[model samples]
Target chain A: AQSVTQLDSHVSVSEGTPVLLRCNYSSSYSPSLFWYVQHPNKGLQLLLKYTSAATLVKGINGFEAEFKKSETSFHLTKPSAHMSDAAEYFCVVRGNNQGGKLIFGQGTELSVKP
Target chain B: AAGVIQSPRHLIKEKRETATLKCYPIPRHDTVYWYQQGPGQDPQFLISFYEKMQSDKGSIPDRFSAQQFSDYHSELNMSSLELGDSALYFCASSFRGGPAPDTQYFGPGTRLTVL
Candidate 1:
């Protein structure tokens, strides 16, 4: 079984400040991890993915995440927070060598404070 | 491309009624998946279709059924709607079959309301 846990249900950050959303996972095998963003009334957009490649994966919109195997975590980070970055973020884990079902975290609602 | 396209952006139905949602996948894609997103919750997998065949069915109930067309389009049919069935139904498409790493593109989703 595979599961993901997002530590924060809501996060607030000031503009131009560094942003971090924490996520942890439990999987039996090596997993494929992904971060997806969903704007209000919009569909989910893939931000980044880690597929057993580089531990540090860069994604769209100047966002990135590091896959930390020892910690069992993959936390999303950004250097500067923009107003447009306000959205719900989901950390997903897909079981390796199994069916292609994705297990999603509870989701983090990011609020950009001006 | 156009990504995935779903029909009936909003639907309302009474109890014991049936609802059908349609989806057209992106061009050159061979896999389609259905997901349900409840309020304030993450999306849950409903079913998946690959090569016009049912690849996997999730924890959905027996009242829910799905079909795929030769053109890679798909339909999700729900019978005997209940209030719990009210949610956003999303259709997604991917390029190939079986564990492909390609990101699934999602449709706008249909908001179903059961009365």
Candidate 2:
């Protein structure tokens, strides 16, 4: 089965500092990758996606991620952190064998300090 | 762009009660997906439908059922709810047949609390 593993359970950073949340996935086929964000008691919002395109994908809210096939990883990064960026981040994967069903990783809760 | 809409943003039910959650997909979207997000847990895929037909299913319990209507709207009907069922239920939609791969757009989710 295809699944994703988030490296950090929680990530804290001071405002204006760089942010990095690691994710590694296991899949038999070329997988579709995505990053979604969830505020407390809110819905999951799409940040970005990787689907056999460019290795680097840019998303909303100044967030981006790179799909490294060699490493089986798609880690999300942000140049600077803001208070509003603090939330739960989920690394998701959808492999062909899964018949397009999305599988989510244990989320990384980001805490941005002022 | 219009986003997926879920009804009864909050629901409270006692054990063994039945709950019906409705989802209205974005305009022109042909697929609908259901997921459950337990507290501090990742969202688990429950079921999905394409063109108002059942397409795929996942870790859904037998006590839970879902179906899509002609209008491409979907509903998840859960029966004999347990305290474990108290979680946020999410509905997502995606458009197929486009040049790009289907990207699921999620709803605000309905928070179900069992007491």
Candidate 3:
């Protein structure tokens, strides 16, 4: 079975400071990893995805995540924080399990402080 | 780019009422997936379809059924609704356009409230 774990339920960061949201995965086969952001009362937006390409992937809004196979981790990060970056982030993994149905993490809520 | 579209952006119904949520996938996309998200909870995969047929299933309730149409649209039908059924339902679409056909594009979502 494929699964995802988001290390933080909530993260707070000061404006202009760096932000990090950690994620780890378990899959029997090579998996496709993704990071999605959902603003309050809004739909999910894909931030980035990893499909056996580069280990380090850059996404929208200056966000990026590194897929570490040795450690089975894919952590998302941003160089600086912005108020608009406040949202719920989900780590998703899609293995060969049944046509790649996504298995989502519990999610991490990001709060940006002024 | 044209994204997935869902109908009945917001719905309110009483228990035992039947509700139908519709989804129109992106043009040329051959796959559709449905997910349910409760308040403050992660999105859970309900089911998925490819080529207008059921391709995969997950965690979906027995009372809920879904199908993809020939036009590549899909519908989620929920019967005997319960308060716990109230949630945000999202439909995503993807095609074999690229190496990662699993890269799904989500719709705005339909907010369902059961009374």
Position A71, candidate 2: lDDT: 98
Give the candidate number with the greatest lDDT.
3
Per-residue lDDT for B1-115 in model 1, tens only?
A: 4778899899999988999999999888888889899999999988888889887778788999999999889999999999999999999888765365446778989999999
The segments of candidate 2 whose C-alpha lies over 4 angstroms from its true place after superposition are A97-99
Best by DockQ: 3
RMSD of each: 1.7, 1.0, 0.9
> Each candidate's lDDT (Cα)?
0.89, 0.93, 0.94
Flag clash pairs in model 2.
none
lDDT of each residue in A1-114, candidate 1, tens digit only: 889999999999999999999999998877889999999988888899988879999999999999999999999999999999999999998644223666679999999999
Superposed model 1: Cα runs more than 4 Å off: A96-99, B97-102
Off by over 4 Å in 3: none
Model 1 chain A: weakest 10-residue lDDT segment is A94-103
Error in Å for residue B88 of model 3: 0.6
TM per prediction: 0.95, 0.97, 0.98
Pairs that clash in candidate 3: none
Q: On a 0 to 100 scale, what is the lDDT of residue A62 in model 2?
A: 98
Error of 1 at B40 (Å): 0.9
Alpha carbon lDDT at A52, candidate 1: 83
